[model samples]
Target: MVHEKSCLIDVPTAEHPRPAAAATLLELMHAQGEVERLSEREQLLSSLLISVNAVLWAIDWETRRVLYVSPAYERVFGRSASLLLADYREWRNSIHPEDLDYAERSLARVLEQGTVEDREYRIITADGQIRWLSDKCYINQQVEPGKPVIVVGIAEDITEKKQLELELHRLATTDVLTQTSNRRHFFECANQAFDTACAQGAPLAFLLLDIDDFKEVNDSYGHLEGDQVLRRIAESGRGILRRGDLFGRIGGEEFAVVLPGCVPEMALLVAERLGKEIQNLSFNYEGQAFGVTISQGLANLTEQDTTLDNLFARADTAMYEAKRLGKNRVLAG
Candidate 1:
């Protein structure tokens, strides 16, 4: 049987031909031992890479061709190494469309800089599932200046980690009962919107809503009924608001909405609709028929407004005026 010559096992060639006649049994045995040792070492390295969870790959930088990939490529990317190696475009096409440009820029930077630290991106697997991957790359040395050099890359699956982080952030920022942004998150988002509106000189509006006689509901029924009332209000208000609107539960019975690109008149219309929606909701607990109402205040961004709090305070004052005038109504500030 003819054995393939490997870099690990040194085989004699024409220039260094073996002295077959004078070679002794012990010398042959030693050479055989050395070959076996090197072969085992090569096999172990191959197996180590194949069995690992992360993808290991090397690519020709100049040609943008994949040179080597471990078996984990198939496991992580849901594609056989043969397909990726055959056409590098297949790998590029696997990246998510939203992330493709960013991924290309990252690779270009690494190639230009000769090294890159960790970077995260998303890719679409063969089965059409989106997965997050964090990878790093470095150029291999020992190549001629003008010749094609190799790039070594390693990537690991970070989809689960990213999902967990998203979940944690949601829990931290979302109201548990209403499933809307909590007070802190609401201000965070409102502040950002305020900054954008100021920079672009765009019209923006704020609405502060409060459930009328909420304490009466809790006192007459129970906290559970009050919680149900709040949930129903949130759901109903969300249904009436536009997709671009930002609505959140700012207090136990108070909610806020930030409407981008909305003027004073548009904000008043939205406040009226939201108030009507909440007033029309019908909820029952323990066979008791009860009704609730809401009061809303509307305010628009003004040149005099310096901070989100200024707008919020104006809306809050108008909401209180609404509550004082009538239980179910909207007042514009």
Candidate 2:
């Protein structure tokens, strides 16, 4: 395509009016060549921009109108650029309700501070899928004084990245053998529960339990059977516990349960019920039948309990007491 500036290239007025006119013809030819080269480069740049896997957009600061958007909008968000350009409010509406305020605040910050680093937010796509996007935006205010202050933004889909991150976190926080919360995550959850219980003045119960003869089972059968026993125990406990209760494996064959809104008596009842369920589970390894039992210690939240460690220690002591009294029994501290 020829530009208006390209059409103004001076050519020879006469066949050979003078040497100056001949020189002007040469200059026109050179200018025409340069314009063609520039046009080719522009086409290449446009192609690259459209083929990219990111959303490239420019918005008019004054009108908040979408000045330009790349074709990738359809590929990424399942929406047409025309729809966005027709009404910039569509862009705002596309943001997830939980993240709309954050997105707006980020834009406001860019407008106020004149620069912004990359920020991440979620969006509800046209196809009804949640997508994570990382937006890198900057303001361009160096244009003509009367012209609009433009904000140029590039947003890329990061949903896969976010999912992978969550998977890794789950792996880190969960027990590999029992599929329960690991020690560190258990403590993290317990700390939160403790703080909430203290703030709300609500009752909380802690149960520390140990599998009876776990080492003997591992020694008689292979570690594989031992793992199966642990998994079974965890499954049984989860089935017996409430939705809000927290159960985790704190050590080898040692597990803890946090029962929110539970008093000492209720906690003891839960422990007894869990022990009964475990006692009924029959373990068979190559036709050798056996059963597993758990000894539990229960403790309730008290005003003197300053930290989770204190509560956990009392429960642990009670658990040892149950073990000392006999196997497969519950004790209260």
Candidate 3:
């Protein structure tokens, strides 16, 4: 019998390998190593993106499509990332109505400026909470010659910082004791009102009020009772003044009011009402009841008054005159 010739060749071993076969095996090994390294790097990058607090996002400028958004997007925006990716208007709808125009214009400027760093605005979240964001965006510089423009941005939640700033401003501008405008802030606002009234050719009146025998009250009733009196007087003044009027505790026992567009008669009427309100407030200390009164001096804006200081000076003089004449009365300077 004739035997058929065997077609199978012997497998090459490492000790006795062909050159081409050896090269192929080495290439396969190298490719496998490269793929493993690449996968590890991808995992590390994903971990970093997931761990960050700020939202990282990308968008296709030409299509107005959201390309990618990191995990933090859902946490900060209180909205679904899937929805944002599905429709670009999801982002637009989240912007505060008052800041929509500004947000759009600032984002558009990034096309010409290459980067926008100082973009800050407010957004309404899905839960109807208003949050502030400091969103910075830049154009990708590695695009091909002809390709859709990609915009990348990082948005950081700055709501806490903004709230802190507002609180600090309130502390700086408001009196801690009486909850009215402090001395410095009162003058600042009064000066602005004075200039506005001058520009509009409107009548403005400044009224300075002093609590009568305030020192004696503090001595007789203790400092706590004196503080209560001050607060009650401030509340009464606030109740009597109009919306546009500026009231502030300018001194220990002195409060000032700047009435915009008020004639002399209207200012006098407001002062009288405030005085009566103060007089009606009864205080009790150690089972003893006592009441307080205020002396007020009113001054009207004149052509000779160049600044608020001039108006304030005349009112101050009149207030002292009221004190000298009798307490619990109003006098026009």
Candidate 4:
């Protein structure tokens, strides 16, 4: 049989690419013994590779033809070795439509620089949902005049990792009970509103509301029902507000409403409507119907109310007035 001259194997009585060694049987016996351990090492390496969970693949450097695929491909790509033999386009096509452009750009950079590339992309699985994959790729060209420098890539599903990251981000940005903006996110939204107000020379007002008898509810009905009331109030407040307005739970049962590009008159009107909505809401507590209400204070970020603290103080005073004058009415200051 005619073998490629560059074949990586030794032979007898032929032009073997492995260093040509001709000696007596006793001398060759020592050489044969030396290679015995190498066979065991090769088996160990092959066993380790086949058992790995990461999907391993090799593609031709020039034509991008599929050269080798590991058994793990069945778990990730759900395709047989035979299907990916001809070209890499099949795998490329399997990539999520939204991620194709980014994958192409990453691939182009890898080819131009011959540098190792690590990337992630989503792929539609046999199931309908998108599954994310993270990959590490490197060029392997150890042998000279090798059949186009083969690209070796390893991929593993990272969908869980992505989900964890998204959930972490949401936890940071969202209020746990109310699902509205938390204190940290409240500041972020207010900063944007401040920018808008400054750019347009329009007024920005903040309405801070606190449940007058909130602690009583918690002490009487337990924290679980109190939490339910908070969530219901937040949902009802959202219904009354516009899309651009920002509402956040800043403290235990204290919430802040940020209105950008709004005057005193407009803000008072909005606050009054929201106050009644909260009062009318019949907060449910463990299959039991109950009546609950809140007192709110309004403060404008005018020249007089300089800092957030100063503005909040005014709103706090106004809110106490709301409680003093009879709890359910809006105290627009």
lDDT of 1 by residue, 75-100 (tens): 88998789899998878898999999
State each model's CA lDDT, in order.
0.88, 0.91, 0.94, 0.81
Per-candidate TM-scores read: 0.89, 0.79, 0.83, 0.61
In candidate 3, which residue ranges exceed 4 Å CA deviation?
Answer: 1-32, 142-147, 242-244, 263-265
lDDT tens string, model 4, 1-333?
Answer: 886666454454455443334456557898788788888898888898778888898888678789888877767777655777865777887789999998778866666666555788898765556888888787766535745677888888888999999899999999989999999899887877876776667798889888878888888888998888899889988998889899999999899998887788999999888878877878666686776888889988776544566666788899889999988767766
Q: Cα RMSD (Å) between model 3 and the true structure?
A: 5.6
Write out the backbone clash pairs for model 1: none
* 2 against 3, candidate with superior lDDT: 3
Instruction: Give one digit per residue, the lDDT tens place, for model 3 in 1-333.
Output: 999998987676888776887789989999999999999999999999989999999999989999999999999999999999999999999999999999999999988899999999999999999999999999987657788899999999999999999999999999999999999999999999999999999999999999999999999999999999999999998888889899999999999999999998988888898899999999999899999999999999999999999999999999999999987999898
lDDT of 2 at 138: 88
Candidate 4 similarity to native, TM-score: 0.61
Ranked by TM-score, the better of candidates 1 and 4 is 1
Which residue window of length 10 is worst by lDDT in model 2?
A: 3-12
**Which residue segments of model 1 deviate by more than 4 Å?**
1-28, 142-144
Best lDDT among the predictions, by candidate number? 3
